[model samples]
Target: MQDRAEATRNAVLHAAAELFSERGYAATSISDISERSGRTSGAIYFHYTNKEQLALALVDAHFSAWPSVIARHDATARPALEKLVGLSFAVARTFRDDVLVRAGARLWTERKSIDIEMPLPFVDWITTVERLLAQARAAGELAAQAEPSRDAPNLVAAFFGLHTLSDVLDDRMLIEDRLANFWLLLLPGLQADPAPRALLARAGGRVTTGHPARVPDGTER
Candidate 1:
């Protein structure tokens, strides 16, 4: 019974994510989710008291999704700047493909209309980027002027803007390439020794050429 109930709840949430992504937050309602999920309105209410709660659930899930991704890359022994670059590509793919993430993104953008406050967007993202960049500095992967605290926000902003444009213009068809372009432009100035452009594949992550990872030379970064 517990497992069945969880499945039902997941079905409803998935339906809600689809609707919330296809239709903006204000435009989506409990009824829409019900129809999409083929679940009774009563069942939905049993899992989620109201539309606001449902929306909150999906948005919160999206927020929860990133940490595991970051943790996965961090767990590996790759260079931090490489991790940073790889993280961006991974995120771009998720934002493009994941309906729940799209719903959360829509909810975030249309947060003004939500009666209840959603988690403040971008704060965690900024913190994660800052941490990765700090690791990059410690790894001697960053350029001398690349202050993590100062640069993290700008990188996040650019990433956010790039995706926003991608979402608006073409349902994110070109986003992977566009993001790779972003990395291409930023890498030379950002990395201690930016490697040849092997092209970042958003479907996976950054594709590197055969060049070896940089070792920290005695000179200051």
Candidate 2:
């Protein structure tokens, strides 16, 4: 019984997410979710008190998957700057693969007037990036005068722009391509050595075009 109930709940949430993406929150009705999920209106109401609560829940669920991605990158023993670059790629990949994220983006923009508390995932991602920037600064990876909070948002905005482009780009640009390009373009401004010319030269000379290089042993170059 518990399993069945959970399945029903997931179905409703999934259906609602899809519908909410297709139709803005204000335009989507409870009946729309019910019809899409093939569940009765009573079932949806039983799981959620109202559409507003369900919308919040949807946003909550969408963000919940992000921390694990952050954790994986954090566990890597890579340089702080590299970790941040990896995190940006991961976020871009998530936005590409997850329909729920696309829907949530739409919902966020559409309901900007609504007084929904900013989602925790967003807060956490920003905090993580800020922490990384601080770490990079401590390690001499960033310029001495750099400010994490102010600069971190710029990186976040760049990632968001990449995600937005993914929605319209003809041949879905790979996350790595976007990340490498971003790093090439943006890293020079942040780093002391500023390898913009070198990295771009290496990237341009590569045979596979924008494919990330691999060492002779087949590991990522």
lDDT of 1 by residue, 97-130 (tens): 8888989889877777887788888888899999
- Would you list the clashing residue pairs of candidate 2? none
Per-residue C-alpha lDDT of model 2 across residues 78-159, encoded as one tens digit per residue = 7677777767766766766776775677677765755567563456667888999998888898866678999887777776
Highest TM-score scorer: 1
Each model's C-alpha lDDT? 0.81, 0.72
TM-score on alpha carbons, each prediction: 0.87, 0.77
| Residue 215 lDDT, candidate 2, scale 0-100 | 39
State candidate 1's TM-score: 0.87
